[model samples]
Target: MKRSYLLIALIILSACSDSADDSNREIDTVILNDLIQHSTEFEKKVYSFENGLHIAVGYGIANSIMVEGVDGNIIIDASDSVAEAEEVYSYFSTINSNPIKAIIYTHNHGDHTFGAAYYYNLEVEKPMVIAHESTSQYVERIMGILNPIISKRSTRMFGTDLPSEQVINVGIGPYLGVAQSPIGYIKPTLTFADELKINISGVEIELYHAPGETNDQLFVWLPNQKALMPGDNIYRTFPNLYTIRGTPHRDVKSWVKSLDQMRALKPEYLLPSHTKPLTGDAVMETLTIYRDAIQYVHDQTIRLMNEGYTADEISHLIELPTEVSNSPFVREFYGTIRWSVKSIFNGYLGWFDGNVSNLDPLPSEEYARRLVTLSGSEEKLFLALEEAVQEKDMQWALQLSDSLLALNYKIDSTNKLRQEAIQYIGGRSLNPNKRNYFLSSANELNRNYEAQPLLPQTSELLREISIDMFFEILSVRLNPKKAKGITQRVCFLFDSGETRTITMRNQIAEISSTNKNCDIQVKTSEQTLKESLAGVRNPVLSVASGEIDTGGQRTKFLSFLSNFTE
Candidate 1:
């Protein structure tokens, strides 16, 4: 009789396993089908429009457009890398072999600006690089203070490290190609504050500073061609009001206003930095629905916030209306409604959710300890995690693993379980951003997983960055532990007639233009200093050769620099 009972229990367990597998398979089928259909939007080809304008789609994460002219052509938004840009230009050359007279950047995003060097170097005179007045400073910030964290998050968000089979698409494009070659960013020569109307290659182009997706975002209007190039503001996928890769709060109101500005022009051609271009009647229809979707989310979120709903609660409550949701342009391929709601909330009210309990919550580890006790014991908590996974309650299993991780109990086992849970959910996710982030997080849990290094910064790229920005970079990188109890002032005299000083006190590096009472003085050209700091040139050799002249003990100056090293 005991043998019969044991056999029955084993049979029941097997049946449950089969049921879960069937359910997962169904979810996977739907997700895979949707992603495959969406991938068609980025089919590699150059889309030629009326009036000598052609856009090369799927060459990289962003579209590179060429406007043919009488003597030369105008290039808008360079691809992602020199390699991708070269490939794109090869195709453009076939259509029109005219020299690239100018290159215009829609924003400061690497995908739009990094490939400009390829086009810039093609001409003897060099194409005039154009952008918003604030573009260069924004680019410096990304490459300077925020480089480390942004690079890591962007790598995961795009699934750049994932095997090809695991990645379907990056929503806006096929894949991110920034790592395929050296970053080829060139500083803009012509920058505008509000608007600039110029004739490039006999093409009457109008550029307006439209801040939406990025603070430096701009829209290009070709009055003669009846074409409007809305950089990243309007794409095929849902607008990333807040990207998972991390970004400053995207101003939703500004985004709506920008779209309305585009609609007012009533252009016949609509070309975006990412995805395919639209023409004729589709232009106004897409712009209207896209703007409506953004406004709806923003207004509804505000309404709920006023009703005392927390961000978490508001996220669950808000949903896109049927008309907006049905439109192909606003599908959650790049961004989702829930994440947007939370971001909108945080943007207005900051981190505090007006909840008393959340105002001063227990530390994570402490909370984990109490939760583990509530579960009877650490061992019981581990069992609960296992049971959650066994029951296919992946989200619960992931939460349980968090407690085990905080306690430092069975870390390897807990991570493995957490990895399995995330991978399962990721495999069935329709949104590529969420899917990639989840899978990338799972990959990170593996003991053998290696993170990719930051993109290589070439000497050419370093020349474009300003010396003042380098000092800002140094200030942020100052090691507080190493700087503790030390006070010193170091002054630098650059060949460009700029004097900057760094004063270290209270474990912080303060920067100023004052050059008086310097503890150590260094004299170097801006380029030489930039190269030395970037490791493109050897500092020891530079100092020994007098390229960098330290007015005092070399060892003392070198030691002071070491305090800023990570």
Candidate 2:
């Protein structure tokens, strides 16, 4: 009776302690928004230059340059949306009512190219859409492989998920999400290889393959006006050598070389896609410093990487010499030196940090459980985290929250604390993308908001790709584990009279254009097929709606369709 009473007393003490801890938990309301300086007010304004060269910067994420030739007009780098594009185009039309002779895409990035369709929609006699030969391929690749993932990250990176008060600017300008304009990516009509000097609307526009930002990046130079439009090659911020939102490897050497090439031109007027235009001495001076700064980081990163130094170590050691660091143009408002160092390091040496333990590690949940055990109990961990928050040690609080969240715990109090910690840290960040990511994550945890169901936007080029490419994309969607020991042959007969056969066996899918002995045959319109492949339409719904006809085995076809999801 005495031992049982002692145990009961211990349980009562523990319950009281738990209740006290919950009552004392407070959310950190310390506002740190004032830490970041907001510059560059976003507005729709046209900056006119000499020799009929006018650029509409600050209109959107991208700027449009209008080269008014003797007969017609030529525009480079269409603004992000239809409204922004039309606004700029209409402004130019008021100045010069000449038909748009040609539209040049500086790169395949959506912000640079999506507004092209607006030009066509305006009935400008279907102005020639010119771009690098690889632009279409890049667009197709993004739509097929990276769109869904990128779409989510972009919503976060641009702070579209956050409330207006919490979202500042996207480093360069205000977030462009407010503009309710749709994007219809127009296909390029004329594609060039390497370099092309073309006379459009009687303007001698020299297009050079100054590929740094994208493989398809091209800079426009007008010899007569002595104006240079470098697209995203020379943006305002310290170049996004590596974007926080995931991306394939960028050619750091090629980027440096591209800057050198631009410097060689020594143009009178330098207008980029993002920032204010520089002229006369400002152009050369800014370009020189930008090139040198980029070169310094690249060279230093490579040199340090040659040694046994890891990415994190190199980031701490290398600094952009005093002059480069102090440059107003190269300030890390968008991209920071630490991120660039890591990205450059990864470019040279892959993701391995030479830590043997990391090569094969336990799942995050298991590791987190071990950590909680080592730290004593979950309640103790929560108490320490609460104390950290009360002390305003956000970094420590964040670390503690990381442990709690590693087990995928979604309790209200813990998530609330984590949200506050992440938001505080994000407000202190100078890098725009980093701030967006941290704040976005915090917002996601705090709110159970649902994103509006919207159709996936695909470029006309994606729709025009070979049907075999579409099958190749579909083949990638098949879940390997789910398809084990499943062998199926399916044939598609489009209303356009094209027939394609697909055979799946042992986790491999083989696609062909010929008719084959198939267990199931699906007949659908070419438009429906395109829409379904682009993830804009549901295949199952199409079948139910009679847009798709399944012959032979409907159950087998539905089973095959079940393996793929949007």
Model 2, CA-based lDDT: 0.74
lDDT of 1 by residue, 37-121 (tens): 7878888889997699999998888999999988999999999898889999999999999999899999999999898889988
- Quote model 2's TM-score: 0.88
**Which candidate leads in lDDT?**
1
Candidate 2 on 84-146: residue-level lDDT in tens?
A: 788788888988878888889999877777777788767637888999999988876665656
Q: Candidate 2: count the clashes.
A: 0
| Deviation (Å) of 226 in candidate 2 | 1.7
**Pairing residues by index, what is the TM-score of model 1?**
0.95
- TM-scores, all candidates, are 0.95, 0.88
lDDT of 1 at 154: 89
